[model samples]
Target: MEEYFSAVRKMEQTVMFPSLLQGVSLGDLANTLDSSSNEKDLYESYTLLKSIKTMVEDGLVPLNQTFPVATQMKEQEIKEEEDLESLFYYHVSSLYRILTRLTRRAKAVTSKYDEIMGQMNQNEKRLSF
Candidate 1:
């Protein structure tokens, strides 16, 4: 889990941030005349990824026992106690999956930006990433 978080931080620090700073456009996915809600610009994606990382860094996970979801939980689920280890595994697995996906997305966006910039050295282009 820590490794996955670290990878996301690295992506933000090394790839996405630099690409964004360079103004490598992602084709204005948001301002299109008939833009669909499903289309997210790379900058928006980067901000989301950064916000998630910030939340994780700030230890903002809701560990409260009486959280809102507690009321919505099924009676059977309320009565049934989940094993801590299993819950940890579930969350860790979920985190791993999401971090992996975000990292891949960051990489793809960087590649697209590099293409837009028409960079010559493939190795140099991806060196920081």
Candidate 2:
């Protein structure tokens, strides 16, 4: 289980996230702030974060069943079990924090988009002379 958590953490930090954010330039964000393009980017980002959360949870399901087995192990094995438990919890907490932040960012993006659309509608009404 420790190995599995370690492998997932490594992939998330070193490969998955970096690849996902690779081409997202600051110019893209600035220019498309309230446009469909920005919404598309935010949706993709949210989806990727959701996928990562699911992967971590799926990996943890099997580990959840090993707690009873850990209690029955010998001294050295018991210590290893404790270590694995801590590692697993640490990954879970980290992923939770990341997901929370991602959720907040998505909300902010949506709000900004709505605000821009509202302003555009008001402008259009005033210009309908």
Candidate 3:
């Protein structure tokens, strides 16, 4: 369980840092657009900048709610050895709920990131205009 918590914490930190870095990148991109000399380049940069913002926001959600993965194994063992159906029902079920919530959140973030990437690609296609 300790290892599980450690892994979850590490993942949380990993997720947080990338989101922060992405925000920094988006800011830098915005600054670049602000000083850009060409109008078309500025518009494309602005579009890319918006997409980056969306990605950063989407990445933050999972970082906010991390769950320890080993909790279920522990509960399962306890349930088998002690014949404690209620404890298993509560702890294991809670872990499942948390896992499902996190999974759904990650999927949503991924979808948002994909959408932003698609928008970025579309903007890239139009950059020559």
Candidate 4:
């Protein structure tokens, strides 16, 4: 169980944080777009957006699925009469909360990506002429 939590924390730090950072950067780039913005900047933003999309699809989504399973397994392992059960429950609950927040963050980032892509499409059309 300890190992499970450790693995989840590692995923959160290594996978989620970098993805979130990329999302933020992408959002910033999107917000800075204007008539003067060039294709190079748009390309870089699109590349970063693709990378983030892949990470969320291939990495974070799987990690998110594991959290609920981990919580369930931890709950199963708990003994009603055990003194340390509360601590275990606390950890499980914490995992659930983290999972919830992570999912929400991912959804927000996905929406931002969609919005940016729409803006980029418009920019591309403007540039084509």
Instruction: Specify the highest-TM-score model's number.
Output: 1
Q: Which pairs of residues collide in model 3?
A: none
Better of 1 and 3 by lDDT: 1
Between prediction 2 and prediction 4, which has the larger TM-score?
2
Task: Give the count of colliding residue pairs in each prediction.
Answer: 0, 0, 0, 0
Candidate 2: Cα lDDT at 58: 69
Taking the tens digit of each residue's C-alpha lDDT, what string does model 3 give over 30-100?
42223332323222323333353455446644633544655566566665767677766977888666444
Q: Tell me the TM-score of each prediction against the true structure.
A: 0.52, 0.41, 0.39, 0.38
Best by lDDT: 1
RMSD score of candidate 4 (Å)? 13.4
Tens digits of per-residue lDDT for model 2, 1-129: 344344334434433333344344324455433342343454455445447557666665454466664557545554667588786786689767655544544444344444555776799999996
TM-score of 4: 0.38
- lDDT string for model 4 (1-129, tens) is 333334334434333223333424433545333334333432343344345445644655554466667777766656543666787687789867644543433433445555655776899999999
The predictions' CA RMSDs to the true structure, in order, are 8.2, 13.0, 16.0, 13.4
Per-residue lDDT tens digits of candidate 1, residues 1-129?
565466565665556334453343445422321233232466565566677778777875565645576556645454554665776686689778777766655555545555544664666769868
Q: Which clashing pairs does model 1 show?
A: none
List of clashing residue pairs for candidate 4: none
